[model samples]
Target: MAELRLMKGNEAIAEAAIRCGCDGYFGYPITPQSEVLETLMARMPWDETGMVVLQAESELAAINMVYGGAGCGKKVMTSSSSPGISLKQEGITYIAGAELPCLVVNVVRGGPGLGTIQPAQSDYFQAVKGGGHGDYKLIVLAPASVQEMYDFVDLGFELAFKYRNPAMILSDGVIGQMMEKVQLGDYKPRLTNEEIIKRYGSWATTGKTADRKRNIITSLDLDAGSQEKFNIKLQNKYKEIQDKEVRFEKIACDDAEYLLVAYGSSSRVCQKAIDIARGKGIKVGLLRPITLFPYPSKAIQELLPQLKGILSVEMSAGQMVEDVRLAVNGKVNVEHFGRMGGVIPTPNEVVEALEEKFIKA
Candidate 1:
């Protein structure tokens, strides 16, 4: 039987990582996300499962540690907030270039500099697009609540190993800090050492052996043609993911005339907004994307043929709205409402914005 428990998002992630058979975790403490480290520390998976947990000197070191472990075919992970993630970009690029499997969690915070410790969605573009200087994409999963935070660890690792690429859990401070009821999913171990050796043994530097060739994992391509070939492979993989890996949630969309598109914590706010709109006899619905990178474009496009308008409520200024617009194909009116710099809007605020901009003529 599966166990149900009340946990904060950060705690859930730590628990899920252990249950998922994650081989190692390397991270430093950062606000809003510091609880992840604390939880993992308290659990002490190292003593029980022999899983390695290290608090690196910095975010850069933590990510590099992840790269080191992944290169050895270990199910590794790292977590940080926005600024710490910014520092991990270089390491992320390195991991992607090497076609390694690892999980990264970014509990977002405000801004370009030393932003506030509060939540912000400003990292949407960074997470969806390549944060580092490269032609690469990370499998980005956006979690709306504490349950998804736990659920996403298994999902993240699965996607990473499936594509031989890095995967990220793109959460924010609110989700990380909020307490919620979560179902501790069935304890299913992801991969055995024997399985790892059988599948990824050719490249992973487990040890030197006379039967195998030396492996050098790197992104350095001297020849343009060689670099292009690598890029082509990555692009092909991304296309496959786009086609088969997208996941999202739809509420009251089948009979709705107006739709609200949002993700992460903002989607929760939109849920409240939908309830308010319905209370006033306005026919509104919601489409929440769980996989932000393999965005629910097809779903949005399908909705366009039936819905009259879409209001995208986000915590960023307007990053996701552009994607919504493109998916709609100019078939219907699409508008945006947002707040930035770590300011979370209340349900009433969202309702008023919807009324002024979308519902009330």
Candidate 2:
């Protein structure tokens, strides 16, 4: 049986990390997400689980710590808000280059520079489109509720290790701070160091052994042909992940005339708007993204033939609207409806936007 408890999204993430047998956590505090660090500090997973949790001097230092731990072939993580996460981009790129598995959480907040501490999905592009330098992708998971916050941490680690890549739980202010009843599941660590090396030692830097020569883990392929080959392999991996890992929720989309595309906190509002639109006899539905990086493009394409148009409701100006456009492929129109800063639009506002943008047409 699953145990039920009221938990904040941030607290659930900390607990999930312990359950997943994460070896280390390094992070610097930032608004709308400091509670994650606070919960870990109070719970002290280090005492019982032998996990190392460090409050680094800055987000940059925190991510570099993840880099170091990942280099050791250990399961590790770091987290922060938008500004702090921005600082960690260089380290993120390096981690991807090394093909080291790790988890990163960006409890997103609005921003071009020092954006508000309020919840926002403005970082959608940054998370999915590679905020760092280079052609790399992170396995970005967008959690719409506190329950998802707990659930996706373990899944994130699994995906990261499986691909020798990084995964992110892209959350927002509402999910992080809001308290809700969450079903706590298993906490056993899935992979051990010996097991990890056995499974991934083809490239991981375990110590040189008698049976074989020294091994090096690096992203550098000086030979152009080798680099291109390496890129092709990565592309194929991304394709495989798209097929197997993309996750999303569809509410009445089968017959929906006007679809609301949302994730994170915005999805909550859209949920209410869907109900309200239904009450008014408007055939509205929702497409909530659970894995933002994978983008749920296939699902969108599947429903494209049925949709009149998609109204992308987000906390940002319109970060995710572009993805909706790509998925719809001009078979149907896509328009964005959102509020910037910290102000969450009311259900009425969202419903009205849907009516004007999609239903009226």
The sequence of per-residue lDDT tens digits that candidate 1 reaches over residues 57-168 is 9999999999999998999999999999999999999999999999999999988799798899989999998899888999999999999999999999999999999999
Number of the top-ranking candidate, with lDDT as the measure? 1
- For candidate 2, lDDT tens digit of each residue in 1-361? 9989999999999988888798899989898889888999898988878899999999999999998888878889998999999999999988887888999999888787997988888888889998898788999998888999999999998899888889999998889989999999876854667886787666667787787677676678789998888878877887888888899999878778878999888888999998999999988889998888778998888887777778999888898999999888888888999998877889999999988876666
Q: Which whole-number lDDT from 0 to 100 does residue 40 have in model 2?
A: 91
Q: How many steric overlaps does candidate 2 have?
A: 0
Clashing pairs in 2: none
Tell me the whole-model lDDT of each prediction, alpha carbons only: 0.91, 0.88
lDDT of 2 at 167: 94
Candidates' TM-scores? 0.97, 0.96
Question: Candidate 2: what lDDT?
Answer: 0.88
